[model samples]
Target: MTESAFINITELTREFKNKTALEQITLSIQEGELFGLVGPDGAGKTTLLRILAGLLQITAGQVVAAGYDLNKEPEEIKPHIGYMAQEFSLYEKLSVVENLMFFADLYNVDVKEQEDRIQKLLSFAGLTEFKNRRAAHLSGGMQKKLALATTLLHEPPLLLLDEPTTGVDPISRREFWNILTDLHLNGTTIIVSTPYMDEADRCSRVGLMYQGELVICDSPVNIRNLLDGDLVKITTSDWQEAHTVLAPLAGVKEIQTYGEALHILVDSGKTRLPQLTRALKEHNLAVDEARTASPRMEEAFISLIRKMDQVN
Candidate 1:
Protein backbone atom coordinates (compact mmCIF):
# COMPACT_ATOMS: atom_id res chain seq x y z
CA MET A 1 0.00 0.00 0.00
CA THR A 2 1.14 3.55 -0.66
CA GLU A 3 1.92 5.81 2.28
CA SER A 4 -0.95 8.16 1.42
CA ALA A 5 -3.59 5.46 0.92
CA PHE A 6 -5.90 5.11 3.93
CA ILE A 7 -7.87 2.28 2.36
CA ASN A 8 -6.59 -0.03 -0.36
CA ILE A 9 -8.16 -3.00 -2.12
CA THR A 10 -6.77 -5.20 -4.88
CA GLU A 11 -8.69 -7.71 -6.98
CA LEU A 12 -11.35 -7.80 -4.30
CA THR A 13 -14.09 -10.32 -5.13
CA ARG A 14 -17.12 -11.46 -3.16
CA GLU A 15 -19.36 -14.37 -4.03
CA PHE A 16 -22.57 -15.99 -2.85
CA LYS A 17 -23.73 -19.57 -3.21
CA ASN A 18 -24.42 -19.37 -6.92
CA LYS A 19 -23.57 -15.81 -7.94
CA THR A 20 -20.76 -13.30 -7.81
CA ALA A 21 -21.63 -10.06 -6.05
CA LEU A 22 -18.31 -8.32 -6.71
CA GLU A 23 -15.51 -9.29 -9.05
CA GLN A 24 -12.01 -7.99 -9.65
CA ILE A 25 -12.86 -4.79 -7.77
CA THR A 26 -9.84 -2.69 -6.89
CA LEU A 27 -9.99 0.79 -5.41
CA SER A 28 -7.86 3.11 -3.28
CA ILE A 29 -9.21 5.88 -1.06
CA GLN A 30 -7.02 8.46 0.57
CA GLU A 31 -7.54 9.85 4.04
CA GLY A 32 -9.89 12.88 4.27
CA GLU A 33 -11.33 12.27 0.80
CA LEU A 34 -15.11 12.49 0.33
CA PHE A 35 -15.74 9.64 -2.09
CA GLY A 36 -19.12 8.99 -3.64
CA LEU A 37 -20.24 5.62 -4.99
CA VAL A 38 -23.11 5.56 -7.51
CA GLY A 39 -24.53 2.60 -9.35
CA PRO A 40 -27.63 0.71 -10.38
CA ASP A 41 -29.33 -1.82 -8.11
CA GLY A 42 -27.33 -5.06 -7.61
CA ALA A 43 -24.18 -3.14 -8.58
CA GLY A 44 -22.34 -4.16 -5.42
CA LYS A 45 -22.17 -0.77 -3.67
CA THR A 46 -23.70 -2.11 -0.47
CA THR A 47 -21.64 -5.29 -0.62
CA LEU A 48 -18.40 -3.33 -0.93
CA LEU A 49 -19.27 -1.04 1.96
CA ARG A 50 -20.25 -4.00 4.12
CA ILE A 51 -16.97 -5.70 3.38
CA LEU A 52 -15.05 -2.56 4.38
CA ALA A 53 -17.02 -2.37 7.61
CA GLY A 54 -15.93 -5.91 8.48
CA LEU A 55 -19.57 -7.04 8.39
CA LEU A 56 -18.97 -9.43 5.44
CA GLN A 57 -16.05 -11.63 4.52
CA ILE A 58 -14.36 -11.23 1.16
CA THR A 59 -14.18 -14.31 -1.04
CA ALA A 60 -10.87 -13.21 -2.61
CA GLY A 61 -8.22 -10.47 -2.86
CA GLN A 62 -6.91 -8.08 -0.24
CA VAL A 63 -8.27 -5.11 1.73
CA VAL A 64 -6.31 -2.80 4.00
CA ALA A 65 -8.31 -0.14 5.81
CA ALA A 66 -6.65 2.37 8.11
CA GLY A 67 -3.54 0.13 8.04
CA TYR A 68 -5.43 -2.96 9.27
CA ASP A 69 -5.50 -5.88 6.85
CA LEU A 70 -9.15 -6.91 6.56
CA ASN A 71 -8.21 -10.46 5.60
CA LYS A 72 -6.20 -10.86 8.78
CA GLU A 73 -7.73 -8.38 11.24
CA PRO A 74 -11.33 -7.56 10.39
CA GLU A 75 -12.22 -6.91 14.03
CA GLU A 76 -9.25 -4.58 14.55
CA ILE A 77 -10.44 -2.44 11.63
CA LYS A 78 -13.94 -1.90 13.10
CA PRO A 79 -12.85 0.69 15.69
CA HIS A 80 -11.39 2.90 12.98
CA ILE A 81 -14.54 2.85 10.83
CA GLY A 82 -18.17 3.95 11.29
CA TYR A 83 -20.62 2.14 9.05
CA MET A 84 -24.31 3.01 8.49
CA ALA A 85 -26.36 0.55 6.48
CA GLN A 86 -29.21 1.43 4.09
CA GLU A 87 -32.01 0.50 6.47
CA PHE A 88 -32.78 2.24 9.74
CA SER A 89 -30.73 -0.05 12.00
CA LEU A 90 -31.51 1.72 15.24
CA TYR A 91 -34.03 0.59 17.83
CA GLU A 92 -37.48 2.03 17.10
CA LYS A 93 -38.55 1.92 20.71
CA LEU A 94 -35.50 3.79 21.96
CA SER A 95 -35.37 7.58 22.14
CA VAL A 96 -32.73 9.39 20.05
CA VAL A 97 -30.54 10.10 23.06
CA GLU A 98 -30.98 6.60 24.38
CA ASN A 99 -29.87 5.16 21.06
CA LEU A 100 -26.82 7.37 21.13
CA MET A 101 -26.04 6.21 24.65
CA PHE A 102 -26.44 2.59 23.59
CA PHE A 103 -24.05 2.97 20.64
CA ALA A 104 -21.63 4.84 22.90
CA ASP A 105 -21.51 1.83 25.14
CA LEU A 106 -21.11 -0.61 22.25
CA TYR A 107 -18.24 1.44 20.85
CA ASN A 108 -16.62 1.73 24.25
CA VAL A 109 -16.60 5.52 24.32
CA ASP A 110 -14.93 7.10 27.31
CA VAL A 111 -17.48 7.75 30.06
CA LYS A 112 -15.97 11.14 30.80
CA GLU A 113 -16.28 12.24 27.15
CA GLN A 114 -19.63 10.66 26.22
CA GLU A 115 -21.72 13.55 27.52
CA ASP A 116 -19.83 16.17 25.55
CA ARG A 117 -19.69 14.05 22.43
CA ILE A 118 -23.38 13.14 22.50
CA GLN A 119 -24.43 16.77 23.11
CA LYS A 120 -22.24 18.01 20.27
CA LEU A 121 -23.48 15.35 17.87
CA LEU A 122 -27.12 16.11 18.71
CA SER A 123 -26.56 19.75 17.84
CA PHE A 124 -24.52 18.88 14.78
CA ALA A 125 -27.28 16.59 13.48
CA GLY A 126 -29.98 19.17 14.30
CA LEU A 127 -31.64 16.76 16.71
CA THR A 128 -31.18 18.67 19.96
CA GLU A 129 -34.88 19.53 20.16
CA PHE A 130 -35.99 16.01 19.19
CA LYS A 131 -33.42 14.17 21.24
CA ASN A 132 -36.11 12.60 23.36
CA ARG A 133 -38.30 11.52 20.47
CA ARG A 134 -38.55 7.77 19.90
CA ALA A 135 -36.67 6.57 16.85
CA ALA A 136 -39.87 5.22 15.25
CA HIS A 137 -41.67 8.56 15.60
CA LEU A 138 -38.94 10.62 14.00
CA SER A 139 -39.22 11.52 10.34
CA GLY A 140 -37.22 9.47 7.84
CA GLY A 141 -34.63 12.23 7.64
CA MET A 142 -34.31 12.54 11.39
CA GLN A 143 -33.83 8.81 11.76
CA LYS A 144 -31.01 8.87 9.21
CA LYS A 145 -29.31 11.70 11.05
CA LEU A 146 -29.57 9.84 14.31
CA ALA A 147 -28.04 6.78 12.68
CA LEU A 148 -25.13 8.91 11.48
CA ALA A 149 -24.67 10.33 14.97
CA THR A 150 -24.49 6.86 16.49
CA THR A 151 -21.81 5.85 14.01
CA LEU A 152 -19.76 8.86 15.03
CA LEU A 153 -19.80 8.06 18.73
CA HIS A 154 -16.51 6.25 18.42
CA GLU A 155 -14.92 9.18 16.57
CA PRO A 156 -13.93 6.92 13.71
CA PRO A 157 -11.78 8.62 11.08
CA LEU A 158 -13.44 6.69 8.25
CA LEU A 159 -17.20 6.66 7.61
CA LEU A 160 -19.04 4.20 5.36
CA LEU A 161 -22.61 5.22 4.51
CA ASP A 162 -24.87 3.19 2.19
CA GLU A 163 -27.72 5.22 0.71
CA PRO A 164 -28.07 7.16 3.94
CA THR A 165 -30.47 9.71 2.47
CA THR A 166 -32.59 7.38 0.36
CA GLY A 167 -36.34 8.01 0.83
CA VAL A 168 -35.57 11.22 2.73
CA ASP A 169 -37.24 14.57 2.13
CA PRO A 170 -35.39 17.15 0.05
CA ILE A 171 -34.75 19.46 2.99
CA SER A 172 -33.42 16.57 5.07
CA ARG A 173 -31.30 15.32 2.23
CA ARG A 174 -29.69 18.71 1.87
CA GLU A 175 -29.14 18.87 5.62
CA PHE A 176 -27.54 15.43 5.64
CA TRP A 177 -25.15 16.42 2.85
CA ASN A 178 -24.33 19.58 4.79
CA ILE A 179 -23.23 17.46 7.75
CA LEU A 180 -21.19 15.25 5.45
CA THR A 181 -19.53 18.31 3.92
CA ASP A 182 -18.60 19.55 7.37
CA LEU A 183 -17.17 16.17 8.25
CA HIS A 184 -15.13 16.14 5.04
CA LEU A 185 -13.81 19.62 5.75
CA ASN A 186 -12.76 18.46 9.20
CA GLY A 187 -10.60 15.63 7.72
CA THR A 188 -12.95 12.65 7.91
CA THR A 189 -12.73 10.13 5.08
CA ILE A 190 -16.30 9.39 4.01
CA ILE A 191 -17.29 6.79 1.40
CA VAL A 192 -21.00 7.14 0.67
CA SER A 193 -23.19 5.29 -1.82
CA THR A 194 -26.01 7.45 -3.15
CA PRO A 195 -28.64 7.03 -5.83
CA TYR A 196 -28.82 10.81 -6.32
CA MET A 197 -26.58 12.42 -8.92
CA ASP A 198 -26.60 15.84 -7.27
CA GLU A 199 -25.09 14.27 -4.18
CA ALA A 200 -22.51 12.50 -6.34
CA ASP A 201 -21.50 15.86 -7.83
CA ARG A 202 -20.59 17.14 -4.36
CA CYS A 203 -17.95 14.47 -3.86
CA SER A 204 -14.24 15.10 -4.37
CA ARG A 205 -14.17 11.94 -6.44
CA VAL A 206 -16.74 9.40 -7.61
CA GLY A 207 -16.65 5.68 -8.37
CA LEU A 208 -19.31 4.23 -10.64
CA MET A 209 -20.11 0.56 -10.20
CA TYR A 210 -21.92 -1.59 -12.78
CA GLN A 211 -22.76 -5.27 -12.57
CA GLY A 212 -20.33 -5.71 -9.69
CA GLU A 213 -17.43 -4.01 -11.44
CA LEU A 214 -15.81 -0.67 -10.64
CA VAL A 215 -16.42 0.84 -14.10
CA ILE A 216 -15.19 4.38 -13.66
CA CYS A 217 -13.53 6.42 -10.89
CA ASP A 218 -12.74 10.08 -11.36
CA SER A 219 -13.61 13.65 -10.42
CA PRO A 220 -17.19 14.77 -11.14
CA VAL A 221 -16.03 17.13 -13.87
CA ASN A 222 -14.03 14.41 -15.56
CA ILE A 223 -16.94 12.01 -15.34
CA ARG A 224 -19.29 14.52 -16.92
CA ASN A 225 -16.78 15.08 -19.67
CA LEU A 226 -16.94 11.38 -20.48
CA LEU A 227 -20.49 11.74 -21.88
CA ASP A 228 -18.97 11.63 -25.40
CA GLY A 229 -21.58 14.04 -26.76
CA ASP A 230 -23.31 17.37 -26.23
CA LEU A 231 -26.74 17.73 -24.59
CA VAL A 232 -29.68 19.61 -26.13
CA LYS A 233 -32.77 20.08 -24.00
CA ILE A 234 -36.01 20.49 -25.89
CA THR A 235 -39.16 21.43 -24.04
CA THR A 236 -42.37 20.89 -25.92
CA SER A 237 -45.87 19.45 -25.73
CA ASP A 238 -46.46 15.94 -27.05
CA TRP A 239 -42.93 14.93 -26.12
CA GLN A 240 -43.68 11.36 -27.06
CA GLU A 241 -43.93 12.33 -30.74
CA ALA A 242 -41.03 14.77 -30.48
CA HIS A 243 -38.84 11.98 -29.08
CA THR A 244 -39.89 9.60 -31.82
CA VAL A 245 -39.20 12.18 -34.57
CA LEU A 246 -35.80 13.25 -33.25
CA ALA A 247 -34.53 9.93 -31.93
CA PRO A 248 -33.76 8.60 -35.41
CA LEU A 249 -32.38 11.90 -36.69
CA ALA A 250 -28.80 12.25 -37.82
CA GLY A 251 -26.24 13.02 -35.05
CA VAL A 252 -28.76 12.06 -32.33
CA LYS A 253 -27.22 9.72 -29.84
CA GLU A 254 -29.82 9.32 -27.09
CA ILE A 255 -32.83 11.05 -25.55
CA GLN A 256 -33.90 11.19 -21.93
CA THR A 257 -37.40 12.30 -20.94
CA TYR A 258 -38.18 14.63 -18.05
CA GLY A 259 -41.87 15.42 -17.96
CA GLU A 260 -42.30 17.92 -20.84
CA ALA A 261 -38.60 18.10 -21.57
CA LEU A 262 -36.54 15.89 -23.86
CA HIS A 263 -32.84 16.03 -23.06
CA ILE A 264 -31.29 14.93 -26.33
CA LEU A 265 -27.72 13.77 -26.59
CA VAL A 266 -26.11 14.41 -29.94
CA ASP A 267 -22.74 14.32 -31.59
CA SER A 268 -22.60 18.10 -31.90
CA GLY A 269 -25.14 20.49 -30.38
CA LYS A 270 -24.10 23.26 -32.80
CA THR A 271 -24.87 21.08 -35.81
CA ARG A 272 -27.81 19.16 -34.39
CA LEU A 273 -29.72 21.92 -32.54
CA PRO A 274 -31.12 23.61 -35.65
CA GLN A 275 -31.64 20.28 -37.36
CA LEU A 276 -33.68 19.01 -34.43
CA THR A 277 -35.69 22.23 -34.19
CA ARG A 278 -36.51 22.19 -37.89
CA ALA A 279 -37.58 18.51 -37.71
CA LEU A 280 -39.89 19.21 -34.77
CA LYS A 281 -41.44 22.08 -36.70
CA GLU A 282 -41.93 19.86 -39.77
CA HIS A 283 -43.79 17.43 -37.53
CA ASN A 284 -45.96 20.34 -36.26
CA LEU A 285 -44.76 19.79 -32.68
CA ALA A 286 -45.15 22.87 -30.50
CA VAL A 287 -41.63 23.58 -29.31
CA ASP A 288 -41.72 25.64 -26.14
CA GLU A 289 -37.96 25.79 -25.67
CA ALA A 290 -34.90 24.26 -27.33
CA ARG A 291 -31.35 24.95 -26.26
CA THR A 292 -27.98 23.36 -25.71
CA ALA A 293 -27.19 22.75 -22.07
CA SER A 294 -24.41 21.40 -19.90
CA PRO A 295 -24.25 17.65 -19.46
CA ARG A 296 -24.68 16.75 -15.80
CA MET A 297 -23.62 13.72 -13.80
CA GLU A 298 -26.88 11.94 -14.59
CA GLU A 299 -26.39 12.15 -18.34
CA ALA A 300 -22.80 10.98 -18.04
CA PHE A 301 -23.80 8.05 -15.86
CA ILE A 302 -26.65 7.02 -18.15
CA SER A 303 -24.40 7.26 -21.17
CA LEU A 304 -21.82 5.02 -19.55
CA ILE A 305 -24.46 2.53 -18.50
CA ARG A 306 -25.86 2.43 -22.02
CA LYS A 307 -22.44 1.80 -23.47
CA MET A 308 -21.88 -0.99 -20.99
CA ASP A 309 -25.24 -2.47 -21.84
CA GLN A 310 -24.47 -2.49 -25.54
CA VAL A 311 -21.17 -4.22 -24.87
CA ASN A 312 -22.66 -6.86 -22.62
Candidate 2:
Protein backbone atom coordinates (compact mmCIF):
# COMPACT_ATOMS: atom_id res chain seq x y z
CA MET A 1 0.00 0.00 0.00
CA THR A 2 1.15 3.54 -0.76
CA GLU A 3 1.48 6.26 1.84
CA SER A 4 -1.58 8.10 0.56
CA ALA A 5 -4.20 5.39 0.00
CA PHE A 6 -7.17 5.45 2.34
CA ILE A 7 -8.57 2.20 0.90
CA ASN A 8 -6.89 -0.49 -1.13
CA ILE A 9 -8.42 -3.63 -2.59
CA THR A 10 -6.21 -6.05 -4.47
CA GLU A 11 -7.82 -8.84 -6.50
CA LEU A 12 -10.81 -8.90 -4.18
CA THR A 13 -13.46 -11.46 -4.99
CA ARG A 14 -16.72 -12.43 -3.31
CA GLU A 15 -19.03 -15.33 -3.95
CA PHE A 16 -22.58 -16.02 -2.76
CA LYS A 17 -23.54 -19.68 -3.07
CA ASN A 18 -22.47 -20.51 -6.63
CA LYS A 19 -22.77 -16.98 -7.94
CA THR A 20 -19.93 -14.50 -8.10
CA ALA A 21 -20.75 -11.15 -6.63
CA LEU A 22 -17.36 -9.55 -7.22
CA GLU A 23 -14.57 -10.56 -9.55
CA GLN A 24 -10.86 -9.98 -9.02
CA ILE A 25 -11.32 -6.29 -8.38
CA THR A 26 -8.48 -3.95 -7.50
CA LEU A 27 -8.76 -0.25 -6.70
CA SER A 28 -7.02 2.43 -4.68
CA ILE A 29 -8.87 5.39 -3.28
CA GLN A 30 -6.81 8.36 -2.07
CA GLU A 31 -7.19 10.25 1.17
CA GLY A 32 -9.88 12.98 1.19
CA GLU A 33 -11.02 11.94 -2.29
CA LEU A 34 -14.69 11.69 -3.27
CA PHE A 35 -14.70 8.48 -5.31
CA GLY A 36 -17.76 7.19 -7.13
CA LEU A 37 -18.51 3.60 -8.06
CA VAL A 38 -20.93 3.76 -10.97
CA GLY A 39 -22.85 0.87 -12.45
CA PRO A 40 -26.30 -0.57 -12.96
CA ASP A 41 -28.03 -2.63 -10.29
CA GLY A 42 -26.46 -6.04 -9.48
CA ALA A 43 -23.08 -4.71 -10.56
CA GLY A 44 -21.57 -5.85 -7.23
CA LYS A 45 -21.33 -2.29 -5.91
CA THR A 46 -23.21 -3.10 -2.72
CA THR A 47 -21.27 -6.33 -2.26
CA LEU A 48 -17.91 -4.57 -2.60
CA LEU A 49 -18.97 -1.82 -0.22
CA ARG A 50 -20.16 -4.32 2.35
CA ILE A 51 -16.84 -6.09 2.23
CA LEU A 52 -15.01 -2.79 2.67
CA ALA A 53 -17.18 -1.93 5.66
CA GLY A 54 -16.37 -5.33 7.20
CA LEU A 55 -20.04 -6.30 7.23
CA LEU A 56 -19.48 -9.25 4.90
CA GLN A 57 -16.67 -11.72 4.46
CA ILE A 58 -14.87 -11.86 1.12
CA THR A 59 -14.19 -15.11 -0.75
CA ALA A 60 -10.68 -14.20 -1.78
CA GLY A 61 -7.98 -11.52 -2.05
CA GLN A 62 -6.89 -8.70 0.22
CA VAL A 63 -8.71 -5.61 1.50
CA VAL A 64 -7.26 -2.69 3.41
CA ALA A 65 -9.00 0.39 4.72
CA ALA A 66 -7.73 3.36 6.69
CA GLY A 67 -4.31 1.73 7.07
CA TYR A 68 -5.79 -1.44 8.60
CA ASP A 69 -6.31 -4.84 6.99
CA LEU A 70 -10.01 -5.34 6.44
CA ASN A 71 -9.78 -9.13 6.68
CA LYS A 72 -7.46 -9.33 9.69
CA GLU A 73 -8.21 -6.15 11.64
CA PRO A 74 -11.82 -5.19 10.95
CA GLU A 75 -12.26 -3.84 14.46
CA GLU A 76 -9.29 -1.53 14.08
CA ILE A 77 -10.73 -0.17 10.81
CA LYS A 78 -14.28 0.09 12.14
CA PRO A 79 -13.71 3.28 14.10
CA HIS A 80 -12.33 5.09 11.04
CA ILE A 81 -15.19 4.23 8.68
CA GLY A 82 -18.91 5.04 8.53
CA TYR A 83 -21.28 3.10 6.28
CA MET A 84 -24.73 4.18 5.08
CA ALA A 85 -26.57 1.36 3.42
CA GLN A 86 -29.09 1.65 0.58
CA GLU A 87 -32.07 1.41 2.90
CA PHE A 88 -32.48 4.05 5.61
CA SER A 89 -31.66 2.09 8.79
CA LEU A 90 -33.00 4.44 11.46
CA TYR A 91 -35.53 3.26 14.02
CA GLU A 92 -38.79 4.36 12.41
CA LYS A 93 -40.63 4.72 15.73
CA LEU A 94 -37.90 6.78 17.33
CA SER A 95 -37.64 10.55 16.97
CA VAL A 96 -34.81 11.90 14.85
CA VAL A 97 -32.89 13.19 17.85
CA GLU A 98 -33.46 9.95 19.68
CA ASN A 99 -32.11 7.94 16.79
CA LEU A 100 -29.01 10.08 16.59
CA MET A 101 -28.48 9.73 20.28
CA PHE A 102 -28.82 5.96 20.03
CA PHE A 103 -26.14 5.70 17.37
CA ALA A 104 -23.88 8.15 19.21
CA ASP A 105 -24.12 5.96 22.25
CA LEU A 106 -23.27 2.88 20.18
CA TYR A 107 -20.07 4.59 19.11
CA ASN A 108 -19.27 5.32 22.78
CA VAL A 109 -19.44 9.06 22.28
CA ASP A 110 -19.05 11.02 25.51
CA VAL A 111 -22.40 12.21 26.84
CA LYS A 112 -21.09 15.73 27.34
CA GLU A 113 -19.93 16.07 23.70
CA GLN A 114 -22.78 14.10 22.11
CA GLU A 115 -25.29 16.96 22.22
CA ASP A 116 -22.93 19.34 20.40
CA ARG A 117 -22.25 16.80 17.63
CA ILE A 118 -25.94 15.95 17.31
CA GLN A 119 -26.88 19.63 17.05
CA LYS A 120 -24.26 20.27 14.38
CA LEU A 121 -25.39 17.27 12.37
CA LEU A 122 -29.02 18.32 12.61
CA SER A 123 -28.18 21.81 11.39
CA PHE A 124 -26.04 20.47 8.57
CA ALA A 125 -28.79 18.14 7.37
CA GLY A 126 -31.44 20.86 7.69
CA LEU A 127 -33.38 18.69 10.13
CA THR A 128 -33.07 20.95 13.15
CA GLU A 129 -36.76 21.68 13.33
CA PHE A 130 -37.73 18.05 12.72
CA LYS A 131 -35.46 16.70 15.45
CA ASN A 132 -38.44 15.75 17.55
CA ARG A 133 -40.41 14.18 14.70
CA ARG A 134 -40.66 10.41 14.49
CA ALA A 135 -38.54 8.92 11.73
CA ALA A 136 -41.56 7.35 10.02
CA HIS A 137 -43.38 10.70 9.74
CA LEU A 138 -40.60 12.56 7.98
CA SER A 139 -40.47 12.81 4.19
CA GLY A 140 -38.12 10.66 2.19
CA GLY A 141 -35.57 13.46 1.88
CA MET A 142 -35.68 14.24 5.58
CA GLN A 143 -35.34 10.60 6.49
CA LYS A 144 -32.29 10.35 4.28
CA LYS A 145 -30.83 13.38 6.01
CA LEU A 146 -31.43 11.82 9.41
CA ALA A 147 -29.77 8.59 8.32
CA LEU A 148 -26.78 10.58 7.14
CA ALA A 149 -26.66 12.49 10.43
CA THR A 150 -26.56 9.29 12.44
CA THR A 151 -23.81 7.90 10.26
CA LEU A 152 -21.66 10.96 10.88
CA LEU A 153 -22.20 10.95 14.62
CA HIS A 154 -18.84 9.25 15.13
CA GLU A 155 -17.02 11.59 12.71
CA PRO A 156 -15.29 8.74 10.92
CA PRO A 157 -12.51 9.58 8.50
CA LEU A 158 -13.97 7.40 5.68
CA LEU A 159 -17.63 7.30 4.64
CA LEU A 160 -18.99 4.43 2.53
CA LEU A 161 -22.35 5.43 1.04
CA ASP A 162 -24.37 2.92 -0.93
CA GLU A 163 -26.59 4.81 -3.36
CA PRO A 164 -27.29 7.63 -0.93
CA THR A 165 -29.17 9.71 -3.48
CA THR A 166 -31.26 6.99 -5.05
CA GLY A 167 -35.02 7.76 -5.12
CA VAL A 168 -34.29 11.30 -3.95
CA ASP A 169 -35.81 14.35 -5.61
CA PRO A 170 -33.52 16.54 -7.68
CA ILE A 171 -33.33 19.29 -5.07
CA SER A 172 -32.75 16.82 -2.28
CA ARG A 173 -30.10 15.05 -4.31
CA ARG A 174 -28.29 18.34 -4.76
CA GLU A 175 -28.46 19.00 -1.04
CA PHE A 176 -27.12 15.54 -0.24
CA TRP A 177 -24.19 16.01 -2.59
CA ASN A 178 -23.44 19.41 -1.11
CA ILE A 179 -23.20 17.85 2.34
CA LEU A 180 -20.83 15.20 0.96
CA THR A 181 -18.70 17.90 -0.60
CA ASP A 182 -18.43 19.65 2.76
CA LEU A 183 -17.24 16.43 4.37
CA HIS A 184 -14.68 15.88 1.61
CA LEU A 185 -13.44 19.41 2.12
CA ASN A 186 -12.86 18.59 5.76
CA GLY A 187 -10.49 15.71 4.78
CA THR A 188 -12.94 12.81 4.88
CA THR A 189 -12.61 10.20 2.14
CA ILE A 190 -16.02 9.42 0.66
CA ILE A 191 -16.74 6.31 -1.42
CA VAL A 192 -20.21 6.43 -2.93
CA SER A 193 -21.92 4.11 -5.38
CA THR A 194 -24.72 5.18 -7.70
CA PRO A 195 -26.40 4.22 -10.94
CA TYR A 196 -26.80 7.83 -12.03
CA MET A 197 -24.30 8.96 -14.65
CA ASP A 198 -24.59 12.64 -13.73
CA GLU A 199 -23.80 11.91 -10.12
CA ALA A 200 -20.68 10.01 -11.20
CA ASP A 201 -19.35 13.18 -12.81
CA ARG A 202 -19.41 15.03 -9.51
CA CYS A 203 -16.86 12.72 -7.88
CA SER A 204 -13.13 13.43 -7.79
CA ARG A 205 -12.59 9.99 -9.40
CA VAL A 206 -15.05 7.50 -10.91
CA GLY A 207 -14.96 3.74 -11.37
CA LEU A 208 -17.34 2.22 -13.92
CA MET A 209 -18.38 -1.30 -12.91
CA TYR A 210 -20.00 -3.82 -15.23
CA GLN A 211 -21.02 -7.35 -14.32
CA GLY A 212 -19.03 -7.27 -11.07
CA GLU A 213 -15.97 -5.92 -12.86
CA LEU A 214 -14.50 -2.45 -12.96
CA VAL A 215 -13.84 -1.67 -16.62
CA ILE A 216 -12.61 1.87 -16.17
CA CYS A 217 -11.36 4.05 -13.33
CA ASP A 218 -10.37 7.64 -14.00
CA SER A 219 -11.29 11.25 -13.49
CA PRO A 220 -14.48 12.36 -15.25
CA VAL A 221 -12.63 14.70 -17.57
CA ASN A 222 -10.19 11.97 -18.56
CA ILE A 223 -13.03 9.55 -19.21
CA ARG A 224 -14.75 11.99 -21.57
CA ASN A 225 -11.49 12.73 -23.32
CA LEU A 226 -11.16 9.03 -24.19
CA LEU A 227 -13.76 9.57 -26.91
CA ASP A 228 -11.61 10.62 -29.85
CA GLY A 229 -13.89 12.83 -31.92
CA ASP A 230 -16.06 15.89 -32.21
CA LEU A 231 -19.63 15.29 -31.08
CA VAL A 232 -22.27 16.66 -33.47
CA LYS A 233 -25.83 17.33 -32.41
CA ILE A 234 -28.31 16.89 -35.24
CA THR A 235 -31.93 17.92 -35.06
CA THR A 236 -34.28 16.82 -37.82
CA SER A 237 -38.03 16.53 -38.24
CA ASP A 238 -37.89 12.76 -38.67
CA TRP A 239 -35.57 11.50 -35.92
CA GLN A 240 -36.07 7.85 -36.82
CA GLU A 241 -35.27 8.34 -40.49
CA ALA A 242 -32.39 10.71 -39.68
CA HIS A 243 -30.86 8.12 -37.33
CA THR A 244 -31.31 5.40 -39.91
CA VAL A 245 -29.61 7.52 -42.57
CA LEU A 246 -26.74 8.68 -40.39
CA ALA A 247 -26.08 5.35 -38.69
CA PRO A 248 -24.27 4.00 -41.77
CA LEU A 249 -22.42 7.19 -42.58
CA ALA A 250 -18.62 6.96 -42.87
CA GLY A 251 -16.62 8.14 -39.81
CA VAL A 252 -19.75 7.92 -37.66
CA LYS A 253 -18.92 5.88 -34.57
CA GLU A 254 -22.15 6.11 -32.60
CA ILE A 255 -25.52 7.83 -32.75
CA GLN A 256 -27.69 8.49 -29.71
CA THR A 257 -31.02 10.32 -29.84
CA TYR A 258 -32.24 12.52 -27.02
CA GLY A 259 -35.72 13.89 -27.66
CA GLU A 260 -35.44 15.65 -31.04
CA ALA A 261 -31.66 15.85 -31.18
CA LEU A 262 -29.35 13.10 -32.38
CA HIS A 263 -25.89 13.16 -30.79
CA ILE A 264 -23.42 11.58 -33.21
CA LEU A 265 -19.81 10.75 -32.52
CA VAL A 266 -17.46 11.02 -35.49
CA ASP A 267 -13.76 11.24 -36.25
CA SER A 268 -12.43 14.75 -35.78
CA GLY A 269 -12.29 16.97 -38.92
CA LYS A 270 -14.57 14.52 -40.74
CA THR A 271 -16.92 16.02 -43.34
CA ARG A 272 -19.66 13.58 -42.36
CA LEU A 273 -21.82 16.40 -41.05
CA PRO A 274 -22.34 17.84 -44.54
CA GLN A 275 -22.98 14.37 -45.90
CA LEU A 276 -25.50 13.71 -43.10
CA THR A 277 -27.36 16.95 -43.87
CA ARG A 278 -27.56 16.02 -47.54
CA ALA A 279 -28.72 12.47 -46.79
CA LEU A 280 -31.45 13.69 -44.45
CA LYS A 281 -32.63 16.13 -47.10
CA GLU A 282 -32.87 13.31 -49.65
CA HIS A 283 -35.06 11.33 -47.21
CA ASN A 284 -37.47 14.30 -46.93
CA LEU A 285 -36.29 14.98 -43.38
CA ALA A 286 -36.02 18.68 -42.54
CA VAL A 287 -32.55 19.37 -41.17
CA ASP A 288 -33.49 22.07 -38.76
CA GLU A 289 -30.13 22.17 -36.92
CA ALA A 290 -26.71 20.60 -36.77
CA ARG A 291 -23.80 21.78 -34.64
CA THR A 292 -20.75 20.55 -32.78
CA ALA A 293 -21.07 19.97 -29.05
CA SER A 294 -18.90 18.71 -26.20
CA PRO A 295 -19.19 15.04 -25.35
CA ARG A 296 -20.86 14.35 -22.01
CA MET A 297 -20.05 11.71 -19.40
CA GLU A 298 -22.91 9.56 -20.67
CA GLU A 299 -21.36 9.51 -24.11
CA ALA A 300 -18.03 8.40 -22.71
CA PHE A 301 -19.68 5.78 -20.52
CA ILE A 302 -21.70 4.31 -23.39
CA SER A 303 -18.65 4.25 -25.59
CA LEU A 304 -16.60 2.46 -22.95
CA ILE A 305 -19.32 -0.12 -22.35
CA ARG A 306 -19.67 -0.81 -26.04
CA LYS A 307 -15.93 -1.25 -26.39
CA MET A 308 -15.80 -3.55 -23.42
CA ASP A 309 -18.62 -5.69 -24.77
CA GLN A 310 -16.84 -6.04 -28.08
CA VAL A 311 -13.62 -7.05 -26.37
CA ASN A 312 -15.33 -9.73 -24.32
Compare the candidates by lDDT and give the number of the best one: 1
Candidate 1 lDDT (Cα, whole model)?
0.95
Tens-place lDDT digits, model 1, residues 1-312: 475699999999999898899999989999999999999999999999999999999899999989999999999988888999999999999999999999999899999999999999999999999999999999999999999999999999999999999999999999999999999999999999999999999999999999999999999999999888899999987999998999999999899988889999999999999999999999999899999999999988888898899999
TM-score of 1: 0.96
Check candidate 1 and list the clashing pairs.
none
Taken over the whole model, the C-alpha lDDT of each candidate is: 0.95, 0.89
List the candidate 2 regions with Cα displacement exceeding 4 Å: 1-4
- RMSD to the hidden true structure, all candidates: 1.4, 1.7
Error of 2 at 44 (Å): 1.4
The CA lDDT at 253 in model 1 is 86
Clash statistics: count for each candidate = 0, 0
Model 2, TM vs. native? 0.95
Considering summed lDDT, which 10 consecutive residues are worst modelled in model 2?
268-277
